[model samples]
Target: MKRLAVSLTLFLVLSLGVGLLVSGSEVLDWGIAGGLFAIAVLGECFRFWIRRTRSKKRDSSSV
Candidate 1:
């Protein structure tokens, strides 16, 4: 989880930096940044859901 968060953050920063350098447009940069942010949030939500389901399975099996 920690690693995932770190990697996602790094990717966002790197992407934004590259986008800014290539486009030099704040409006486009914000658009790209918003898309990336949405993707990151979705990824985290998916990860959390997977972990929750796995833990529930483990708990049921143990009982």
Candidate 2:
């Protein structure tokens, strides 16, 4: 249940960011929508990677 809530929250935040970018692009350059989405995903992946590594280090240190 806690994991589900976290997943849902991330999904909603990503969707909101992408939706805004796509919608706002209607007035500017629309081609960058895909690029923006890709960049967002890349950033998120990097953040997740950092978090995972930090947690692993912490867990190993405590054991």
Candidate 3:
């Protein structure tokens, strides 16, 4: 969880920095930053879920 939080924070900061550097419009910058943040969060969640499910399958098969 701590690692996830750190990764998410890093993603947000990088996205915001990139957005600001790439776009002149305030709204577009924020939109780009928000979109990237959402993608990072969803990707992390999906990876966690996949790992959890795989572990569960392995544990059950070993029983």
Model 1 misplacement above 4 A: 21-28
Kindly report which residue stretches of model 3 are placed more than 4 angstroms away from their true locations once superposed.
Answer: 25-28
lDDT of 3 by residue, 1-40 (tens): 9999999999989998878887875645778788999999
Q: Estimate each model's TM-score.
A: 0.65, 0.51, 0.85
Model 2 C-alpha lDDT versus the unseen true structure = 0.64
Candidates 2 and 3 compared by lDDT, better number: 3
Q: What shift in Å separates residue 10 of candidate 1 from its native position after superposition?
A: 1.2
Cα lDDT computed for each candidate against the true fold: 0.76, 0.64, 0.89
Q: In model 2, which runs have C-alpha deviations exceeding 4 angstroms?
A: 1-30
Give the Å shift of residue 10 in candidate 2: 9.5
RMSD of candidate 3 to true structure, Å: 1.9
- Candidate 2, RMSD to the unseen true structure: 5.2
Give the least accurate 10-residue stretch of model 3, judged by summed lDDT. 22-31
State candidate 3's TM-score: 0.85
Best by lDDT: 3
Candidate topping TM-score = 3
Task: Name every residue pair that clashes in candidate 2.
Answer: none
